[model samples]
Target: MSTFIAAFLFLLVFFLLMSIGYLIKRKAVQGSCGGLGVLGIEKACDCDEPCDRRKAKDAKEKARQERLAQHRII
Candidate 1:
């Protein structure tokens, strides 16, 4: 039980230090290894033309935004 408590305290202090360092630097949190490019994906939407399903979803989102704008109080 004491050994477990010591290990937990060590890990807690280690992560606290890491968090403070990140806050000081304001660095973006990302994968430890290189981002998705390692898997050959340049981006989520790399295709020149979006697929029909994606197109429909985008259109729906656009329409929703337009409706919200029309009803916005300002």
Candidate 2:
């Protein structure tokens, strides 16, 4: 019947669009923080371990402080 054909066409188009979306997501680069970094906010890692970016920032800050302390003796 015509009703059955229309329903089948609608479902087919819906599934095709879903498949395209899935493919796009799979090819895209995944962000660590759900795009919070783009908004200038620090994104926490979802892993059990500390984030590498956080560790690197901490290390950089510690180095800068040490340098400042060394210069203060002059």
Candidate 3:
């Protein structure tokens, strides 16, 4: 029937729009990094400062923990 054909066309258009939207969304997702980093996009630091800070903090913590463990062992 004509009604059936119209409905089918409507559904086809709807699905095509949905597919295009999904493709655009997929492309956007692929383009973005999901913001999973220490710095943001604007101030993204590729320098060694953050790495140095992290290493220094880790070393300090390790030294403190080792000192405590040595005391406990005594």
Candidate 4:
């Protein structure tokens, strides 16, 4: 029937538009959020070159140890 065909076409168009809208929204969200950061996304700093893993770890451990020693004195 003409009425049935019209209804089906309307629904098909509506759903197609909805799918396109959802895809656009998903892309927008991904663009804004980006990838995860260890500390936080807002405060994360992008370095020029990748950090030296061994030296960084050693420095962090030393700093932590110093903090612990200072706390023990208090």
Candidate 5:
């Protein structure tokens, strides 16, 4: 019984820490990598093509450039 209790406590703590890490990751990080790089497997997407985040960022940048061009007075 004591051993089971100890194991349960350890697992509980582990899961709690994992949950906190996931929350922090979701709130604090941006962008996704498609390769097995240093960040970790969790940060990597399994897609064969570009990820959605990069596509969105590229689209945003393009829109900003268009707006700037429109505002330019030359």
Candidate 6:
């Protein structure tokens, strides 16, 4: 329909303009209210000891880092 095409074009242009503004600013997007920093909390999941899921994620990250380190020639 003509009405639908007009509305779609308007939205497409609006989104393109918003994206251009963001690209010019080059800033990371964050919640409007800030986040854990506002509450003075550090890590998202801060436990005395990490849970199983957290442990696995950490181990995976560690392994990834080690693999990257191994690939380094210098």
Q: Write the per-residue lDDT of candidate 3 for residues 1-74, one digit (tens) a residue.
A: 99999999999999898789877665332435556353454334555456877679878989998997888633
Candidate 2: misplaced stretches above 4 Å?
27-74
Please report how far candidate 4 places residue 23 from its true position, in Å: 0.5
lDDT of 6 by residue, 1-74 (tens): 99999999999999898799888776556678868878877768867888999999989999998997899655
lDDT (Cα, tens digit) per residue for candidate 1, span 19-63: 998887766567778777888887677788999998898899999
Give per-model CA RMSD: 7.4, 15.8, 16.2, 16.9, 11.3, 5.9
Please report the TM-score between candidate 6 and the true structure.
0.44
Query: TM-scores across all candidates?
Result: 0.53, 0.35, 0.35, 0.35, 0.37, 0.44
Q: Count the backbone clashes (under 3 Å) in each candidate.
A: 0, 0, 0, 0, 0, 0
Task: Find the candidate with the highest TM-score and give its number.
Answer: 1
Please give the lDDT score for candidate 3. Answer: 0.71
Local distance difference test values of all predictions, in order: 0.86, 0.77, 0.71, 0.70, 0.75, 0.85
Candidate 5 segments exceeding 4 Å error: 27-74
3 versus 6: better lDDT goes to? 6
**Deviating ranges (above 4 Å) for candidate 4:** 27-74
Worst 10 residues of 1 by lDDT: 26-35
Q: Could you tell which candidate, 2 or 5, scores higher by TM-score?
A: 5
| Cα error of candidate 5 at position 69, Å | 25
> Tens digits of per-residue lDDT for model 4 on 4-64?
9999999999988878987766433244445555445542345545468855976898999
**lDDT score of model 6?**
0.85
Return the clash pairs for model 1, or none.
none
